[model samples]
Structures are given as structure tokens and as C-alpha cells.
Target: MLPSASRMRRGEEFADAIRRGRRAGRPMLVAHLKTREADVPPLVGFVVSKAVGGAVVRNRVRRRLRHLMRTRLTAIPRGSLLVVRANPPAASARSEHLATELDVVLDRLLRGRRSESRTLTDGRS
Candidate 1:
């Protein structure tokens, strides 16, 4: 289970991340990440729809994702929000596979963000 402080519980928060944040996708999951200017602990949310599976499968997948995410929490920037949506493929994927995908997508997303911020600062300095 994620620590309550690190979880995103509101619908609007999820919507903001999914609709306005930077996104990265893999065969098993899609990650939407939104950054804020303040330095606070990052918050994370997960979505596993019916298309992914029934209650049992969805819960299982959610638990696996939650645990996997715990390992990567430090990688997230302060005050940022992240939503991880599991696709149907996630229902059958092993935890290791899911972790691999998560790492890849997050690396791509965060690496791009770093370069973007650099460009912005470089232009002004």
C-alpha cells in the first residue's frame, strides 16, 4: 500500500494529470506526469479499468503496480503528480515485466522533461 501522503485521491487531480500532463506509454501501461513549482512529496494514482479485467484481476494488478511504484517513488520530482493507467495487457503481465515497463516510460518522460527545462533556462541565461 502507498503511504497516504503519496497517493492522489481526487478525481480532478487525476483528470488534470491525464489531460494536461506529459505522458509516456508502453505495452502495459501509460503514465501521465504533472510537475509543480513547489517542493513537496510527489503524489501518485493508478487506474485499472474493466477492460483490463474483473475485480480480482484488477485488484491484483493494482496491488502489483502499487508495490512496484514504491520502489521508484524517489525518482519523482517534488510537488509532481503522476497517474499510471494499466492496459489490458497488464492483467497478465508479471510484476517484473510491469516494473521494467514503468522504469522505461518514466525514464523517457523525466529525461525529456530535464532537457526541456534546460532549454528554457539556457534561453533566458
Candidate 2:
């Protein structure tokens, strides 16, 4: 389980991330990440809708994704929020498949952040 501070608990938080964040897509999921100014650690939320599966399959997928995110929590930068929405394919995906997809999306997101920060710094002087 993720620590309380690391879990996004409020609907507004999730909405904000989805509304203002950059997005990365995978075969099984879509990730939206928004960087914040606060000093708090990153917060994460997941959406596994009924389209993904019945209760049992959805729960299983959510559990797998939760564990995957927990292990990679350190990779999340401070003062950012992440929301992951699972697609129907995710209900049938193996853990390895989910992990690989997650890695690809996260890498893209992090790379985008780095480039944006570089552009800001380069324009400054």
C-alpha cells in the first residue's frame, strides 16, 4: 500500500491533474502528470473503470498497478501529481506487461519535464 501522503485522496486533486497535466499513453493505460510548486512529495491516483473488467478482474489489475507504483515512488519528483487510467486491455495484461508499459510512459513524462526545464533555463540568459 502507498503511504497516506503519497496517495491522491480527493476528487479535486485527480481532476486537477487530469485537467492540467501532460499525458503519456500506453497500450493498457494512460498517464497524466502535473507538476506542482508545493514541497510535498508526489501524489498518485488510479482509475480502473468497469469497462476494464468485472469486480474481481478490476481489483486484481488495481492491486498490481498499486504495487508497481509503490515500488517506483522514488522516481516521482517532488511536488507532482500522477493519475493513471486503465484501459480494458489492462484487465488481461500480465504484471510484466503492465510494468513495461508503465516504464515507457514514465520515461516519456520525465524526459518531457527535463526538456521543458532546460528550455526555461536556456531562455533566461
Candidate 3:
């Protein structure tokens, strides 16, 4: 499980972030990330809608995503807010498939961030 303070729980705030954040997509998930002025580590928000399945299924998906982040997201930079949404296909995905997909998305997001930082530092668009 991710630490309490590292979780994003506010609905309106999440909506705002999703609207403004940079996006990275994969087969099983979509990630929205915003760079914040806060001093804390990344605050992640996970979205698993009812369309994924019944109550049990949604919770399972949420749990799996959280676990993936707790350990894997360490590579992500600080002061970032990340929201990951589950698509309908996630209802049928096995844990291994979901895990691999999350890893791929994170990798892509981090790569984008690095390139963006270099661009900013070098005065390139």
C-alpha cells in the first residue's frame, strides 16, 4: 500500500489535475501527472470505475494498482501528482498483465519528464 500522505483522495482536485496534467497512456491504464509546488513526495490518485466490474472487482483493481506504485513509483520524481485510470479491459486482465502495463506507463511518463526537464534547462521548447 502507498503511504497515506502520498495518496490523492480529493475528487474535485483530481478532476482539476486531470484536466491540466501531462498525460501518458498504456494498454491497461492512463496516467495524468502535474508538477506541484508542494514539498511532499508524489501524490498518486487511482481511478477504477464501476464499469470495471462489481464492487469486489473495482477494489481488487485499486489494490493492485496501489501495490504497483508503492514500490515501483520510487523512480518517479518528487512533487508530482499522478492519477491512473483503469479502462474496461482491466476487468479481464490478470495481475501480471496489469503490473506489466503499469510498469510500462511509468517508464514512459518518467522518460517524458526527463526530456521536458532537459528541454527547459537548455532553453529549448
Which numbered prediction scores highest in lDDT against the true structure? 1
In candidate 2, list every pair of residues with a backbone clash.
none
TM-score of 2: 0.95
What are the per-residue Cα lDDT tens digits for candidate 1 across 12-112? 98999999899999999999999988777999999999999999999999999999888899999989989999999999998789899999999988998
TM-score of each: 0.96, 0.95, 0.92
The local distance difference test score of model 2 is 0.92
Model 1 superposed RMSD (Cα): 1.4
119, model 3: CA deviation in Å?
0.8
User: 1-125, model 2: which lDDT tens digit per residue?
Assistant: 77878999899999999999999998799999999888898999999999998999989988898899998889989989999999999998889999999999998988998899998989952
Candidate 3 residue 109 Cα shift, in angstroms, is 1.3
Ranking by lDDT: 1, 2, 3
**What is the total number of backbone clashes in candidate 1?**
0
Task: Write one digit per residue (lDDT tens) for candidate 3, span 10-88.
Answer: 8876886699888888877998888777767888899998888999989988998898889976776677888999987
lDDT of 1 at 62: 93
Q: Which ten residues in a row have the lowest lDDT in candidate 1?
A: 116-125
Model 1 clash pairs are: none
